[model samples]
Target: MKISAELRAFSGRLGHDFARPELLQRALTHGSIASTTRPDNQRLEFLGDRVLGLTMAEALFSADRAASEGQLAPRYNALVKGETCAAVAREIGLGDVLKLGRSEMLSGGRRKEALLADALEAVIAAIYLDAGLEAARGVILKHWADRLKNVDSDSRDAKTVLQEWAQANGMTPPRYVQTARSGPDHAPEFEITVRLDDGREAIASGQGTKRSIEQAAAQALLDRIEGTT
Candidate 1:
């Protein structure tokens, strides 16, 4: 599909233009479909992930002069986390612009937070490739400045945040239950259902080692409750 119109308009909204829109396309393409067809977005994702980290670190440094490296790490993680990235992607209609295979499209890949996050990172990499690091930093600063201002750049991990929220509300500690486990034992994808004593449950699905799944589940629960409150 010819994506120039969409790319051009998106670039304009981003306050920059891409000399090569194909890079943008490759950045937004998900591996599910693009693995066999094209280079896919993974490489861009790798590059964009670093770009996002560096951009966020710079923002934190400029905004919080008193913060130490330890203090800034978690804050940086929160801003550039998958959920935050997905939110930004949604804000700019990245999901709609994404090119998916028939199967992925039918499966609602456009709405998946992980896919949205990955695509956003790819787009960042694309912008970086098209223009320069400064251009990409401008885009990040434009979209994410507000979040950077509001969230504590020195906050702890999501699990800690979730626990604190539960404690503050006088509720029992949050429980993470393994609702479904799929894929091979060597490479399992866990579907965790996090429940609060207050009769609320938020499910998070993640593919990883056991430890990572636990963290993903906790992060999912934290986001769900945070959104509600």
Candidate 2:
């Protein structure tokens, strides 16, 4: 099968020359544009997620022999989270080669964090299938090297830390409310408020989906409370 020049370039960026190019093609296909002729990457994404988790776990365990599971769990989550995956996808310019449907393309699907993250996982699975687990591990470690090295800085999610703080202080879990939303249907800005039971609160605005925005808001609040901002 003849592959497009664009896909060839994408493979170059991905740092893996696929033996079965069709796997790469299927990995790049989105559900929005899937059909009998072209299947989507959902199954690949599922498999890739497990591959990513195992690779990250092994990396962390080997890198820090003295660290307890408590310390390592946060680092694992930080490395395998969708936000990190989306950031890696952007680093490799994965969005430029995505096969999105007309509606999705029109709605800026290429820039959507969730889509990019899922596609990146699918690509990982494709590499694993094409070669083996070692190939997938190589790609993941190459892309995530910096993050792995700096994993100790802020490994836990902000929300989890905040919840821990609240419980320690004999308070309820922090509550997050979507105070406002604006912009077009395709790209929206979210304003979220994170409130503590003690009347302390923080407000922040973020771009992308509501869930991510809420996390960002919680992080912002945590930063402020911890005097890290």
For candidate 2, write residues 1-229 as lDDT tens digits.
7889999998998889988999999999999999999999999999999999999999999999999999999899889988899999999999998999999999889998889999999999999999999999999999999999999865867788889998998999999999998988778989999999988888888678777777787888788888943
Instruction: Point out where model 1 deviates above 4 Å.
Output: 1-3, 35-37, 153-172, 176-229
Model 1 gets an lDDT of 0.80
Model 1 TM? 0.71
Question: How far does residue 49 in candidate 1 sit from its true spot (Å)?
Answer: 0.6
TM-score of each: 0.71, 0.85
Best-fitting candidate, scored by lDDT: 2
Residue 175 lDDT (model 2): 94
**lDDT of model 1 at residue 224?**
73
Instruction: Record all residue pairs in model 1 with backbone atoms less than 3 Å apart, i.e. clashing.
Output: none
* Count of residue pairs whose backbone atoms collide, per candidate: 0, 0
In lDDT terms, how accurate is model 2?
0.91
